[model samples]
Target chain A: MTTPTPSSPSGPSRLDPEPTPRRDFLGLASLWAAASTMLFAAIGMMRLPKAAVLSSPSKKYLVQLPDSLAPGEAFEPPGRAVVLFRDEDGVYAMSKVCTHLGCLIKKNGDGFDCPCHGSRFGIDGSVVKGPAPQPLAWHKVTRVGEAYMVDEGVAVPTGAKEQA
Target chain B: MSDSPIKTSQSALGRFWRNLAGAPRAVWRAAFRSGAPTTDRTRSQFVFNNIFLHIHAVRTHRWSLRWTTTMGLGIAAAAAFLITVVTGILLMFYYKPYPEAAYDSVKDIHFVVPTGRFIRNLHRWAANVMVVTVILHMARAFYTAAYRRPREFNWLIGLGLFAVTLGLSFTGYLLPWDQLAYWAITIGANIAQSPREVTDALGITAYFDPGGFQRQLLLGSDVVGEEALIRFYLLHVMILPLALSTLLAVHIWRVRKDGGLTRPADADRRLGPPPGDVYPVFTDAPMKTYHLAAVVRGRSPAVGKGPENTVPSMPHLFYAELAALMVTVLVCLALAITWHAPLKEIANPDVPENPAKAPWYFLGLQELVSYSAFMGGVGLPAIVLLGLGLIPFLDREQEGTGEWFGGPGGKGLVARSAIFGLAVVLLVETVAIGFGWIREWYPEAPQLLITLLNPGTLIAAAYALYSMWLVHRYDSVRSGAMGLFTCFLCGFIVLTIIGTYFRGPNWTFYWSMADWPKH
Candidate 1:
């Protein structure tokens, strides 16, 4: 530890007792009041970006399965992230969003390929290559009489499918 | 009182005339406290009196005025930034930030608003110029080893300035809301999300995803849309400019505090001391004997220096600064007049541009991303930036502080490093392009392995090995740093050129644009 030289300016000294305790109490109370106000203000400010209502495309969308779609073929609904597939196993929906970064994967032949990163997923939504740790997610598909309701926000088991 | 001097003017008309006659002198005096600087003392006072000009020292080393030393790159960058600010503010008058109106506003600025196109073009050209000049300025500082001793902090600040410069450029790129801007920003946002690669590989993304967090923070959502446009606009117009200006002030202030610029130790002797010593000899007899002077902890910049080699900054330094600013303005104006900043069709999210490229500066990174997204975009850039930040700290030797390439031997080292770097990058890219990566050969390859062993990582590893070899050969840290920096520079240039010119649709390699298959 370094000691100050004789010529050096001295460090802080012991503080004297408060001359006006009541005044000090009042000042402290006001300071706390201001601090709490600011804290609440900051908390309120933080809530602005976490909006209660978000202006975005609805996650749950209804997509009509194309009648012409053959077995094992995928049909991507416009403005939706899920790809509906019709196979002998019945009807299923796989999310086209790449698990790696979120670039919409294109259906390359039977599997899906990410354009940003080369992550391939099998037609069954199984990871066929590395870089993409998880397989393409399977979205919940509920049979709605004529059209199927696909929930893009919900992920189900890989083989879960709705009866055709 | 009225009888004194010639007959005093007692009338109101006479007083008004006298006040009017004295107004010019009063205004001039208020602006410049000192008169014309005929003498050295007045010249010093001239600088000291002006708040704006006082950042510069009264006396500057004649060597600093030499064009070959710094190449005026710093001032050029400052000039370009100034031009950018002026033109940016002008464009802001008619330019809207909303996604709905941003594209049309840019078109109006391009074709409708009088002189708006010119202002926008100038802003664009000057911003690019600023980036280039700032980069070159850093290169100048590095090759000269100016980051030694008292100037290391300033060098770090310079790096911060460079980063802010790039940030400004990236943010500004999205304001037009065109396909180019939208797609480039999309690629940029994706790059920000590259941390997912590692997190996913480790099977930890479900619990913690920093990549996604960063992307959300940057674009305010998953993708570049309305939120992203507004966020980038705020950053471009306000936040980044404030940051840059604050850092720039400190940077220049530190330069003055650290003694104008780094110069040779024997600079005064080399230049043969300005005409003669301006002060009386104080080192003689009684003054030396009576004064009890102790060695100080830090260097005394003026120690043992006669005043002969230093010239007043009044005309010399100001003249040089003015010339640099003028040249920068002229070049920017010439470019603005000749070219129209490109604006492609408005952004269409459904129609993704094939082979979508990031801005040219980041194209090198994009090329690396194609190799391995996480490694190329995030991991390697982090490593490179960390290495750059550590350069001055690692190479602490104070010798060869002012000469280019750390003295004569550095020239050969830099040349060799550049050539080696160019060859290594080309060879690695060529191999990767011709035969493909391990993943291409083995479909079952692990991502962790691929991330650690791609063309980007290979080139970086090669550069590190070359730098190590240089350290061993020269037995000097400076030589190693010089090698590494030179190699990195060359690699970036090569990668950027290839990314811009060679890569085509689906990121396939082609010799020329003509050879690329039509979409």
Candidate 2:
């Protein structure tokens, strides 16, 4: 084996390196700045919200019902839109959108039937059969003195027991 | 049968013209000098006859069949990539990136566009094939120690390419924007984003954060919408493709630079010179080293004659590669034509999907996630990927000279041990992941262990421990590390494959209630 000469300067090893050059530092900073600027611009364009269109002008209120509808009595409005059902407690409004594919469900006997995918929902907005994963969401019903009010914003969860 | 020199020249020119269809003078010169020129070599010569070819052409002993197999796998992957690109472009003509138009465009493709179904099928099948080929390529590389020194950087780049490949697959998954694609990508992106947590009495944040960067760079906003779709589209079609292509070029170039595939005799030949001076004095080494080593080992050196074993690219490997490429393309086309890509109902962002499944490649990890909040959430897969990326630096043994088992050139007990150990670890992990899924589907007796400790969490913990032990053992005892690492790698492969095959519909999460709340 050859012995090392103490006086001689060692050659640069493969592992060791030096600090970044001024030019490289400047170049990297400029590149980063450019990339960030482009990213911010793109994001700004994407987040620019467009004006919402009013599709159904005729239907102002989702559903308008009498002070009370008796039990087992159902109200199917025009356009096969929202269905209003009454029980001893209050009036419940459920949209026709099927849980499976958003197909409008029609009243078949006691429950609603989805024409597109054959999903079935009971009178209480509970799923009965077919491909629907859960019961239909029930809108909140308010007993305004004697009359009832349906709030579309307060959509109730389809409880686990309601699933087919 | 010896002909006069003039007659030979005439015959050569005639054959050249017939083969090349009116060859130019440059082609003639190259053919004469190189014996027979391949398309790649011909193109190389045409471009610039410098050191580039030296950096591009793959060199290996003919009998080191694994290298050829690897190249075959890579070509298969490249073919799949091409298919995906072509089909993706075709789909792009009909697809709209916006949410409102995305589902409608898909409907149009299925109903209105001519051969749209075929295009969709091609894209799907090609994506699947790309995933398979990449995995196979990595496996072959590991087995052959192709990731060893000088090629270490290339190995890291290979890992990057693997990541990009998966990214392309995952991102493209959402473009259809159907129920399956939407929920699948959502779950996948969620898993991709799941925080990396370390377990204690209370959970601690891991050093690295998962999905944080992905959220910023990929999603941009909180959810998958127009922004996500556009970003994924650009990445799938342009950014990833360019990056992968550039990296692939560099990878191949490095493979050539590192003197191609290592031969069994290379170890013995390298033993003659000291480790430091082995490269430059390589040609001066005694030929006896190769002959004697091969004879003693009961194996013949694949390359004939001395160390200067070189083969012409044409009519041999090039033909094989071309044949492979053609076969790949034909198979992809056939699949594309036969099967229609799945497109379920339109994606309604307000609705929740049930049992949301990630892409197939990530199923193994997803399956793990279902078992425990901790293991599937953060621990094992992260460590594995990070470890894989760091493999090149860990295994610093010089490729050509290292022995199998001991010292400089022997295939000793250490390598064998490593292989077997890795195989065991893989087997255990497979059983663990599988059992975890089964337990989830059918609960075992309500016991403390069953309730508190999920199989996924246990398996992940075991895997993590094994990986840590592997690194430690390898460092402490040089001989056994190879065997252990091999075992670790094999375990992952078995787990992934078995997990993929067994999970059935769960692999793609076809259940309608993907995101529905389960009591």
TM-score of every model versus the real structure: 0.87, 0.58
User: Highest DockQ, which number?
Assistant: 1
Computed on C-alphas against the true complex, the DockQ of each candidate is 0.23, 0.05
Candidate 2's residue-wise lDDT over B256-345, tens digit each? 666565444454353343334112212445544563333321235534434334333333445666777888888878877777778888
lDDT of model number 2: 0.58
lDDT tens digits by residue: candidate 1, B431-496: 988887776678677778888988999999999999998888888889989999998999999999
lDDT of 1 at B261: 84
lDDT of 1 at B332: 95
Off by over 4 Å in 2: A1-164, B1-55, B58-71, B196-217, B265-307, B350-354, B372-378, B398-454, B464-519
